[model samples]
Every structure is written in structure tokens, then in C-alpha cells.
Target: MAKMTLESLRKLRVEQKEAIERRDTGDKSIHIIVGMGTCGIAAGAKEALNVFLGEAYTRKMTNVVVKQTGCMGLCHAEPTVEVKMDGMPDTLYGKVDADVAKKIVEQHLLGGKLVNEHVFDYPARDIHKE
Candidate 1:
């Protein structure tokens, strides 16, 4: 390795900061949470996660955050993904493969439309009030 220069150090710092900011969710409103538990992983959640992250980066989605969590207790629906966005009902999608992940990014995140078929859960509305 060559000697480190002051200018080169500063450039490196800037580049590292930008990369960190991309993964930060401080200002992001939309959150895509992928289940990464044993069952989910067995069902290919890792591939689904990669698709979501890649799609977000490729589409220049600055307001979206992709993250991972443990099992959501939907073992029957392994490889689940939950999407929460402002102005839209929080939705959970099941059996998310690579194709389903892309569809979630394109149809739900970009077009602001829910991908109805894969939706496993959604906020239930109250029907009666006292």
C-alpha cells in the first residue's frame, strides 16, 4: 500500500459517508421489511432481499428503506415482506420470490398501488364504534 495523503483521506471519507447515507433510514418514509428467520431463509428470503435492495438502488428511490427482521410468525407464508408507506395501509406480502420482490418495488412502491395477490395481511378497519 502507498502512503496516505490528506487529500486522498478526505475523498475517502466523503465516499464512505455517501455509502452510509444510502442505508440510513432517518429521512426515509417508506420501509420494506424482509423476514430473515430460518424458515424465511429456507424459502429464499435472501434472494428476495437482494432484489428489493437492488431495485431500490437501480430506481433511485431515495425515500425508501429496505431492512430485515426475524420471523413474523407467518411460517406458512415464509419469505414474507412487509411494506409501510405514508398514505397507504401497512401491508404484508407472503411467498416473496425475486419476481414478487420486483413487483412490489415497481407496482407498490413506484406506482403507489398495492400488489393485491401476494398481500398476506393489511390493517383491518374498525366496523363499529360505541
Candidate 2:
């Protein structure tokens, strides 16, 4: 066993504190959920998921989090992706492929525009509010 040193203890404490702080204040502003159920995977959800992850990394997008979920009960619309972002309606996009994933990241995430053609569901609101 290695003997404890004061310098080592202090360094460990600092590293732990920084890790805790990062976890506590993650504050990701955008959440992208890809359906990974059997139906989704068969419809190419894996590729879409990879594209999303790759785009986020290649583009250095810090405020976004991409994750996977089980079936959303929209099996007919496999490869669905639900995106939740501040100041925008939570949107579920259907038939998401690699191309659509790129569009979502570029046009929706970056340009703040919905890919209306692929949108399957979203919160209903009065048009007058817009």
C-alpha cells in the first residue's frame, strides 16, 4: 500500500471538487432524445444517433446533450427524435436518418428553425402567439 502524502491528498480533493462542480452545474440547454427500440434500430436509428453525436463533437456544441430512449409508441414512425430546447416547442421528428440528423443539427439546433417536413409531433399552441 502506498503511504498517504499531504500533497497527494490536496490534489485529490481539488480534482474531486472540480468534478462535483461540473456535474452540479452541467446546465445543458438542449436535449436530443433518439428512440433506440427495436423498431427504431431497424429503421436506422443507430446511424442517426451516431450522426448526432458526431455532429455535436465535430461542431463543438457545448450546450447540447444527445441521448437515447426506448420506444416512444410511435412504432410506425420509427427512428424518431425528440428535441427539447429553450424558447422552442418540444418537437418529435419522425423518420430521422443521417441526412435528417444533420439537418436537425444545422438548421434546427444552429439556425433555430424547425425541420417541418420531418416533424411528427409538437405542442399545440395558438398561431396568434407567434
Candidate 3:
């Protein structure tokens, strides 16, 4: 990658600031990925994804990006959600419902806190590797 010029750096700073504003003064926005494998779909991951999207749009959260992917390899923990923040390590939450999604947005995105009980800190496979 090339080093950013002063002007480019300023542009990046402005973009970051706008993202923070979209997050409502929260330091980092969230990237939410809902697992859509067979198990996950069976467990209602589709509904969870819809809930996140609805919340993002209704709240006008331009910073929060939501997406869908295949299996996370934790069939037991179906309906998984991968949450990524700017500075914090990624976290995966399982068995998510609309209510849980709302709480995640409130407690995690807004308050910058992790919901410990719902976090899946360990996975059998290394999905992060490329």
C-alpha cells in the first residue's frame, strides 16, 4: 500500500469523523455479518439479518454495515453474528433474535461494551485466515 499524502490523510480523517457521527458519537461503527449456512438459516439467521438491517436504516446508522455469509462452522451455534469494530477484536454472537440484535446495537455499538454471555470467543476453525 502507498503512504497517504497530507490531503488524503485529511480526507480519511473527515470520513472517519463522519462515520463516528453516524454512530452517534460512538467511536467505532459495527460490521455485522449474519451466518447464512443451512444450520444458521434453519435457526433463523435470515430474520436476524433483517432485524439488523431494519435497525440500521431506521436509526439512520450510516456507519453500521450489515452483511450475510455462509457457515461459520459452528452449527451448534447457529444464527451466528460476527461483529467487528474499529479498535476492538472481532466477536461472534450466536442464537441471535431481533431482541438480541437490538440489545447488541444498544450495548455494543452505542455503549462500546461487549455482551459477554452472548459472545463466542472461540471457534474450532480459523475463519480469519486467508
Clashing residue pairs in candidate 1 are none
Q: Residues 1-130, candidate 2: write the lDDT tens digits.
A: 7998999999977986676577673665799999999999999999999999999877756567899988777778879999999878888999999999999999999899999999995333541122
Q: Rank the candidates by lDDT, best first.
A: 2, 1, 3
**lDDT, each prediction:** 0.84, 0.85, 0.82
Off by over 4 Å in 3: 1-29, 126-130
**lDDT string, candidate 1, 27-59, tens digits:** 647999998989999999999999988888776
lDDT by residue for model 3 (1-130), tens: 9988999999987986687666585545579989998999899988888888988877867678898889888778778999998766688898787788888888887788987888885565476443
Model 3 TM-score, all chains together = 0.73
Better of 1 and 3 by TM-score: 1
The alpha-carbon root-mean-square deviation between model 2 and the true structure, to one decimal in Å, is 8.4
Provide the TM-score for each candidate, comma-separated: 0.74, 0.72, 0.73
